[model samples]
Target: MALLVAGAFFMEILDATIITPAIPLIATSLGVEPVDVNVAITAYLVTVAVLIPATGWMTDRFGIRPVFIAAIAVFTLASLGCAFSVSLPMLVAMRILQGIGGAMMVPVGRLAVLRYSDKADRVRAIALLTWPALAAPVIAPALGGAIATVGSWRWIFLVNIPIGVVGFLLALKLIRGGPASAARPLDWRGMLALGGGIAAALIALESVRVTGTNWWQVATGTAVAVVLLVLAVVHLLRTPHPLITLSVLRFRSLRITVTAGSLYRMVITAVPFLLPLQFQLVFGWTPLRAGLMVAALFVGNLTIKPATTPLMRRFGIKRVLLVNGVLSVLWFALLAVLHPGLPIWLIAVILYVSGALRSIGFTAYNTLAFADVVGDDLTHGNTLNASVQELASGVGIAVAALLISQLTPLVGGGPGAAYSATFLVLAALLAVTLIETLRLPRNAGAEVSGTRIRRRDR
Candidate 1:
């Protein structure tokens, strides 16, 4: 069961990261600029961001098995469509559909695992499930680059088809059907407002990059996004059974967890996106070389996985997070000092170390975030965290790209200057997370049940 669930998790996350290296190839094939090709990536991420909030409701409305199967089908078919897309716009549209499929895959699959798993096994299950999410980005760029170098960029999308097909079949056969939850009224209004707000905000951010931050356009988009967001908040406050269930916010530990989780993910998000670009644009490395270099992140993540649980037990969450967060920030800052003259192997080693530290830091954050939630709130808290996680990732990448785009010209497009400036900025942003980490209670880690959930918990 864990294997199936983890497979699904890996597929979703792998698709998200794999497309990064393919962007340049995609651009050339479609007769579009590389930056313009990023629209496909952004479209998929934004679609996931917009749709993820609704997954819990969908799972409740439809049985988990059916929903998971349908999600896989959609994602698989969309991957086929993406491979066959003849133009950039067509590919972007296909990616949005793919996003819709992926949006439900992780949370719904996770909910299934959590629903069935015993309390004692829940944390371990979650930790195991998170490996693919951690590992995907590590291997994605290298894999994507290799595929693109050997075949067409279309192979990246095509690769998902076989995996998705297997997943769908396995899900149908192995996933159990259960008595459905009583249907609660869907929060249609709340969904509209929340979805609209998030979509608007993401579009606004993307627009700032595409439209050069023209005051009028930026101001108008920002205003629209703010108004939509405000409306969502107001709706959440007034609605009976809001989309996200605001009552989840009442858990102090959960509150801190979600807040810190968002900030932490935001910082982690900047690394993969910026590092590859830094290697290619700054150090004049080929896409494949840059991707191979970036694979150090996965190495670190993999190496640390065996130790994450034990380390959390030893140092505790607060101390672990505080020390690790500071170290992670320093890792980001170190990139600012990297130059073309530096040995590539040395840089890879540094990144490898950073990746290990980052993996430990991230695992700690995720485990601690849900440590305090119990019973019904646990489900809602998990849903809310999933939504925020995706949102933070999208926003983080957008923000980093926008900043780097602006800084590049100012740095005279010299070797490593733009990359240095961007890394410095990211380091500064990460430094703020140290303050957030301190907000966790000293004994918070000790309070966690540290139990793994089994199939019956739901």
Candidate 2:
């Protein structure tokens, strides 16, 4: 069950990251500017963000097995459409459809694993599910670059078809159950407000990042997004059986996980977004070589997974997080000083350690988030977590882009200086996350992590 869920999660994440390296190639093939093709990426993230809130309801109203299978099928067919697209509009539309499928696939699949697994096994289950987050982003750039170098960019989307097909078949045969209990009514009004609000906010963020966008356009987007989001908050708070139960956030574990964990995630998420651009633009490395260099992070990520659970058990979640978070910030500080004159091996080593810290930090955050959540609330917590994660993925890219756009002129209009400035800013912001971790009770998450921290008062 963990493997199946993990595989589906990997497919969704891989699709999202694989396009970064191919964006320019894709734009050229479609007779558009590289910057314009960013719409394809933004469209997918926005779609997923908008649709994620309703995933729990959909799984319950429909059945988990059927919903899971259908999502995979939709994603696979959309991949075909994306591959055949000859124009920018066609590609963006197809990506939106793919996003819809992904929005359902990931949360529902995760819910299934969480519902069936015992608490004692949660660390292992979450570790399995979390691997895709680390593996996909690190591997995608190198794989996408190689594909672009040797063949057409269309292969990037086409590659998902086989993985999706296998996932769909396995899900159909292995998954159990028919329609789930729909005791609670669907919150249609809440869904509309939340989806529209999130979509608007993402669009506004993307608009702010674009250098060519007019000031008026960014202002309008920002205004509309804020109004809709405020309205959504009101609706969710007042509605009976809200689309998602906000009350779960009252728990300290979940509150910190979603809020501060998201801040940390943005920095980690920015790596794939920034590393490729920095290497290719600043160091004058080819896309393929830059991608291969990025793979060191992925190797480091995978190498550290088996140790994560044991480390948490021995050290406790809070201490582990604090140590890893500080290490991650320090690593980013090192990356801020990277130069073309630096040896490739040295750069690779830094990335390797960075990857290890990223994997450990995120795994700790994700596992601890659900430490206090149980039974019926698992669906709500998982849904909300998934939504925040999607939002972070989009916002992370937007933040990175906005920083570079703002810093480029200040740094004398060079790509290398702009990227260096962005890393430094990110490293500084990431320090705030460590402060947030400090707020965790000294013995926080000890129950779920299977470790005890000795307290001074005791």
Candidate 3:
């Protein structure tokens, strides 16, 4: 089941970002400015962010089997719609439709894994689910770039057809679940408020760029988003049955994941998105070459997985996170120094290290999120975490795009200096998470990691 959900996750993330390296080609195909096609990307992201809040309710009202399978079908069909799109509006519409399916697949699928997996093996289960999140974004660019460079961007969507078909068939045989015995009534007010806030927030972030940004639009969206989000938080706390139970956030470990862990996620997620574009645009590399270079992340992510469990068991989660956090800051600083003249192997080495640290951080944070939550709180925790993760991913991409655009001019060198400055800024932001991490007790997540705290530590 973890593998199944992981596969679905890969498909969802791949579809969402497959256009990243091909953005220029897509703009040309649609007969529009390259910047205009950002909407197609943001549309899908905002739709997914908006719809994610309701999936927990959906999985409970309908069986997981039904909801998961339906999502796969919808996602697959929408991919076809995206392929056949003749205009920007048509592509954005199809991507939005695809987002609806994505909004359902990940949260529902992850919820199933959480419910079924034994507590003793939660680390293992989370490990399985984490790979797609780490690998797909890194790999999608290479795959998309290859397709676009060799042929047309349309083939990117077409590729998902077979994967979706196989996944749908296997899900029927492997998945088993029914609606919860006591399903709570849908909280329409909470749902609308939360969903609206997320959409507005993404819109506000999406509105920012280096050139020709509508300041009025950004301010209006920001103000409306702040109002809606506050209302959403208030209503969720007061409602008898909120769309998502905010109370689950009371757990300290869980709170850290949604807060500091999300910041970590947002910063790391932007690296893969920014690197390829920087290589192609600034370094004058072909899309295929740039993407292949970024694929080094794949090697690093997987190669380090076997060692992660041992590292956690030996040093403990808190210790591992602190060390990794320090190294990540250093890693981001190193990334800022890249130039076209650098050796290819050296660049790959830096990316590989980035991937390894990312894998470790994800495992530690994901496992920590569930370590202290028991029984009933688990479901809501999973739902809330999933929602936040999706929002962070969307915002990360939007912010990275904006930063690259805005910082280039302000930094006063070129695209190269802009990317350099962005990495340094990201490094500074990650350093802040180290402060939050410092506040965690030494033995944090010791249960999941199976690390024994020493008497001296106590």
lDDT top scorer: 3
Clashing pairs in 3: none
lDDT tens readout by residue for model 3, 1-458: 99999999999988877787777778789997555566777778767866776876787889899999999999999999999999998998999999999999988898789888899988999999988967786688789889988988899899989999999999998877899887778889877887788778767777776678888999999899899999999999998887777899889999999999999988887787788677877888877787788888766877888899889999998999999999999999999999999999999999999989998998889888988999999878887887777677767777777777778789898779999999998899889999889999999988889898898876
* Per-model TM-score versus the true fold: 0.89, 0.89, 0.89
Clashing pairs in 2: none
Name the better of 1 and 2 by lDDT: 2
Residue 270 lDDT (model 1) = 69
Task: Please report the TM-score between candidate 3 and the true structure.
Answer: 0.89
lDDT per residue as tens, model 1, 162-241: 89889988998877645356867778888888877777776666666533466676667778879988988888888888
Q: How does model 2 fare in lDDT? A: 0.82
lDDT at position 164, candidate 3: 93
What candidate 1 gets wrong by more than 4 Å, as runs, is 113-131, 178-181, 209-214, 413-415, 449-458
Q: How much is 353 displaced in model 2, in angstroms? A: 0.9
